[model samples]
Target: MSREAAAPGLGHNGGPPLEDPDPDAGYRAYVWRRAHRKAWKTPPPEIALRRLARAEELGMSYKAYTLEILERGRYL
Candidate 1:
């Protein structure tokens, strides 16, 4: 049998698995994650209190309400 048939796990090319073809993909993903977390940082105490009140009135959890605002850029 050929090398490819000998090691099916190495893929059809018979090379190591190409889980991440792009070398810069990891750094880009890390930057994206950092930005995403920054966007969801805790609001100020007064704003948090207001959002909590509004969330309670709307019968939604604080996290759900906040996620709605973050994703839709609007108050619900």
Candidate 2:
């Protein structure tokens, strides 16, 4: 075969072509979600109250603080 024909995926795109966007994408997503649930735990109400207080002290709303924790696993 010609070089171009042999090199079906070689181009500016810069990687092997996707035969499937995801072969086991569903399984992978399921595993990731399971792990995430295992890693994240809800804090007790008192801890939540302290976090709210700290958020107020930092001039941030409680909602913003909780969202930050959910996104990053900690408040910045």
Model 1, residue pairs in steric clash:
none
* Candidate 1 segments whose C-alpha is farther than 4 A from its true place: 1-6, 9-20
**Residue ranges of candidate 2 with Cα displaced over 4 Å:** 1-18, 32-42, 70-75
Candidate closest to the true structure, highest lDDT: 1
Each prediction's TM-score versus the true structure:
0.67, 0.48
**Decoy 1 TM-score against native:** 0.67
Model 1: per-residue lDDT, tens digit, 19-76?
Answer: 8589998999999999899878988999999999999999998999999998898888
**After TM-score superposition, what is the CA distance of residue 70 in candidate 1 from its true location, in Å?**
1.3
Top of the candidates by TM-score: 1
Predicted structure 2, TM vs. truth:
0.48
Model 2 pairs in collision: none
